[model samples]
Target: MNTIVDFQQFNNATLEQVRTRFEEEFGVMTYFMNPAPRPCFNKICMSELHQSQTSLEKMQGEVIANGKVSQANYLVLASDIPGIFNLGGDLSVFGDLIRAKARDHLLAYAKLCVNNVWTFYNMQAPVTTISLVQGQAMGGGFEAALAAHIMVAEKSALMGLPEVLFNLFPGMGALSFLSRKIGMPAAEKMVRSGKIYTGEELYQLGVVDVLAEDGQGQYALNNWIKKNHRSLNSFQAINRAKQRVNPLTIEELYDITEIWVDAALRLDERNLKVMERLVRAQNSKVNSDVAHIQEKQSA
Candidate 1:
C-alpha cells in the first residue's frame, strides 16, 4: 500500500503563508513558514497548517513510485522570515475577540491551534517531523516548536512564553509538550516565570534536542541527518516509544484550551491594554521590516 505524495502542488500552488522545498536527494520536504503581517500563527497560518498536513498524509507509506524509492523520511519545519520564527497568536484578533466577549470564537481559534499543532506532534505518517528554530518563537509559536518530534534550535534563537505578560497563559500545547520534554515542575516554572531563554539555555535544560550555532541551523540539521542516516529507523522508533510511555492526547489539549478561553474572556480592560500595546509593537516592527525588504528589492 503506497500513497505517492504529490509535491508539485506545494511547488506551484498559491500558498501565501508557507513555502515548500523538496530535497529529493535526501527524501526531505521542508516547509518554510512565513505568516504575513507579523510572522505569527494567524488565520492564514491555520489554513496553511491544514494544507501541510494534507501533503504529509499523502506521504504515508510512500515507498516506491515510478520505479524509484522516493519515500520522504524527514519533514523539516522552518521559518522563511529572518530573526522571527513566530510571535505566537494574533494578538490583535485576541484583543478584539476578548473585548467582544466572543468565547465561542476564541475557543474555536484555540481548538484550531490545538488540532494543527497536534498534527505536527503526531504526524501519523512514517516520516519524522522536525522543527528548525532560527529565531524568536514566543507563546504559541514556542508551543508549536515544542510539538515537533525533533527540535533543533540555533544557539542564539530566543524563545519564551509571554502569555502571562498580558494576564493569560499558553494554553495550546505548551504544558503538555514541555512537561514531556523537560518535566512538569520545570514546565510550570517556565509558564509562570514569563522568561525568555536562549537556545543554549534550553539545550542545557534538556528541552532542545539539538543546538546549532547562530545562522547555521540548516547546516546543523543536515549534519545531524547525515550522522543519523543509517540509524534513522532507531531514532524515529525511540521517539515513538517515548510517546507510548507518556502520551499527550488531543483531549488534554482541548481541556487546557477551555481553561485558557475562560481566562481570556475574564480579562479586564487593563489586561487588554497590555495586549494592545504588544500588538502595536508587532505591527510597527513588521511594517518596518516589510519596508526595508521592499527598499532592498527596488534598490
Candidate 2:
C-alpha cells in the first residue's frame, strides 16, 4: 500500500527531546508501533518492533525511531498499555505481504527490527532499559522485554511464547535469548506449552528480574530506574559477562526461527488444531496446579 514516512511530529524535535518523551511515555526508551486498541484496525499491531502492515518504508521508519532514541543512551523502548506490552507480529499482515510476494523485504525488515532491539539490549549505557509488564507479552513482544537488562512486572503480567498458537514459533531471537535466561527446560516448556505466566511465576523462573508489589509494575519500573541510573553500566557489564557463556548465537537461532517461519507458512489446518490441543492441555495442567497452590495457601 502506501509507504509514506510520517515524521510530522518528530520533524523539528531534537534527539534528546525524543529520548525524554520516549522514557516519559513508555517508562523505558523507544517508540510505540500501535496506538490505542482498535480491533481489526490492523491485525499485527506490535509496539516494540515496527509492523509493516502497509509498506516497507514505514516499517524502516519505525526502526529509525528506535535508533534515534538508542543513540541518546536513555530508555529506547516502551509500550502504551501498562499490562499487555505487545501481542507480537501480525499474522494477517504476514498473510497479505506473502500474497503480494513481499516476503524477502518483510524478512529483512524483521531482521532490522530484531537487531535494533538486540542493540538496545546490549547497550553499555548507564541509563539502562526496563519493561513495565502487567499483562500479556507474547512472541516478539515477550522477546523485546527479555532483551532488556531488567524486566519489572506486576504479579499479574502473563508472558509466553504463543507463536505456536498462530502456526509459527518465536523467530524474533526470543528462542535464543529466553532459553539462555531461563535455561533449556523452562524455555522449552514455555515454547512447547505456549504457557502464559503471572509476573511472580516469571520471577520464580528468573525471567522477570524484579517483581512488582500489589501489581504496581509501572511504579516499580520508575523506582528501579531512579535508583539504578548510576549502576546501569556495571549491570550491563555483569549481564553481558554471563551472556557470553551462553550456547545459542544469534545467527544459529535466527536460522532456527526461519525454519519455524517456513513451517508456519506451510502449516495445514490439521497441524494447527493439534498445536491448539497441546497448548490447551498444558494450560489446563498449569491452571490446576495453580488452583491447588491457592487452596493450600488459603487453608
Candidate 3:
C-alpha cells in the first residue's frame, strides 16, 4: 500500500488492460485509473483507510497534471472494496494521536484529509467529479462522497456520519458540504443522530444525487453522464456560481478542524473506550471480509 503506482502508465491502455493494472495495484489501499466510456477517466479507490487520504493527496496531484494536458470531462470516484465503499477515518490513528496529546499530528492528518476533500469539492479541474458508492460509506467516507459534484449510490448502500457515537463530529468537510446539499438543520441532525441511512433514504433527503439498483452503481453513473452530457457546461457553471455565492473555503475547513482537535482532546476514558470498541468492529469487519474472499478463491 505504501508503494505508489503510476496511473499515467495505463492511460492509453485497453479496458481489459486497465482492469489488469487496477488489480495489480490492489493492496491494503490503492487507486487505479481507467478510461471511462465517455470522454473522461475514472479513479477507483480500493483501500482500507477510507479513501486513503494520504494517497489521495498524491493522486489528486497527478489528476491535476493530467487534466492540464488532456482535460477530462468527468472524474469518477468508485470503490473496489465490495460491500463497503469506505468505513471512514482511521479511528486507530485518531485514538493514538488523541491519547498522546499530539495536537500537531492530529492537525496535520486533518489538513491532509481536508486537502483531499477540498480538491473533490472544488473539482480542481474543469472535469465534473462523481462519487459512485456501492456499499457502506460511513463518517469521513460519507464526507468524501459529499465532496463530489455528483453522488451515485446503490439502493442498498448505507451512508452515515457515525462520529457522534465516539463523541466526535465529521469535521473534515461534512458539515460544510452537507449543509450545502441538504439544509443546515437536516445536516446538523444527520451529524448528531449517529444513524446509518440507506441510499434511497439519502436520495430522498437530497444527500444522494442518484440511486441505482443494487450492483448497478456504475451503470447509473454512466447513464447520468450521458444524460447530462449536453448540459454539462451549464451544470458546471451553475455549480461554480453556487460556490461563489456560498463558498466553503480551506480556511473554514481548517478552523473547523481546530475545533475538532479541541473536541477530540476532551474525550474521557469512557469515550475512548467506545472508540476502541468501534475500532475493533472495523477490524473485525475487515478480517471477516478477507476470510470470505479467501474462501471464495479456494473454492
Candidate 4:
C-alpha cells in the first residue's frame, strides 16, 4: 500500500497520445501526454483524452468503493515526449482540411477538444488536477496545461499561444482559464501578442501557480502535493467556491472554439502557408526527439 503503483495496473489504458502512472503513496494519478506521429494534438490524441478520462473514472470508482471521495486527491498531467510538452493542434491536418473546405471536420475536432478540456477543468471527482510543465507548451498545449486546477512548471519552460501567427487564435479554454487567473484584458493581450512566456514570466503573471528550478518540475509537483494534501479538503472547498463565483461553462468554451474553427476556415492562402511551415517545424522536432532517444539507447 505504501508503494507507488501505476493506474495502468488496474486499467491498462493504451498510450498513443498519453501514458498513465499512479503513485499510490499520494493517490496521485498522472497522465504523461506524448502525442504520437508528430508530437502534436492529432485525432489519436483527442481520442486518447477520452481513454484517459475513462481510465480515471474507473480508478475513482475502485477507490470510492469504500464511499470515500477524497481517496484520490490528485491527478497530474505531464509529458513523456522529451523537451516538448506539446506543439499544439495538428497543423498538417488543419491545413489539409481547411484547403478542402472541411468545416465539419474542423468543428468536430474543436468540439472534442473543448469537451475534454472542460472535463479536466471540472472533474466530477473530489480531486485536485495539476499540470507539470518541464518543457515547451505551445498553443493548444499551453491551453491544455491551463485546463488543470494547478500548474507546477520549471522556470525555464516556454509556453504560449502562437495561433495568431497563422491568423487564428487558441479557442480551447485558454481565454476562459487565463481570464480566471489574470484579468480578461491581460488574457486578450497575451492571445494577441503571441508572445512565448517563460515559466518564470507566467509565474510572475500569476498564471503558473508553482515554479521550480530547471529539471526539477516533478520534484516541485511532489513537494507541492506533500504541502497541500494535509489541507486538501479545505483547499478543494476553496477551489469549488472559486468555481461557483467565477464559473466556466462547457457552452462558453464550445462557442469560442467554434469561432476559432470558423476563423481557421476563413484563413487566406498566405495564412495556410504559415501553418504548413509550423507543421514542418513540428515534424523536425519529433524527428529530432526520436533520433535523440535512439542515440541514447544505442549509447
* Model 1 bad stretches (over 4 Å): 1-13, 61-69, 294-299
* Model 4 lDDT tens row, 1-299: 33333444445655556665655667877777777787778888877776676556656523422223325568787888878887788889899889999999999988888877787888877778898998899988899899999999999999999989988989998999999999999999999999999999999999999999999998899899998888988988999999999999998998898888888989999999999888888888888879999999999
Question: Residue-wise lDDT of candidate 1 within 1-299, one digit each (tens)?
Answer: 32334444443346778876656566777778899778899988877776676666665825344456566788788899878888999999999999999999999999999988888888787888889999899999899889989899999999999999988999999999999988999999999999999999999999899999999999999998888878988988898899999998899999999999999999999999999999888888888888899999999
lDDT of each: 0.86, 0.56, 0.70, 0.83
RMSD (CA, Å), each prediction? 3.4, 10.0, 8.0, 2.9
Tell me which residue pairs clash in candidate 3. Answer: none
Q: What TM-score would each prediction reach against the true structure?
A: 0.92, 0.66, 0.80, 0.92
lDDT of 2 by residue, 76-98 (tens): 34554433466555544555455
Cα displacement (angstroms), candidate 1, residue 169, comes to: 0.5
> Regarding lDDT, does 2 or 3 come out ahead?
3
Candidate 2 — worst ten consecutive residues by lDDT sum? Answer: 52-61
Write the residue-wise lDDT of candidate 3 on 207-259 in tens digits.
Answer: 89999999898778768877887887799899899999888898999899899
Off by over 4 Å in 3: 1-5, 8-70
Error of 1 at 152 (Å): 0.9
User: Which residue runs of candidate 2 sit more than 4 Å off their true CA positions?
Assistant: 1-33, 36-76, 97-102, 124-127, 247-249, 269-299
Clashing pairs in 4: none
Best by lDDT: 1
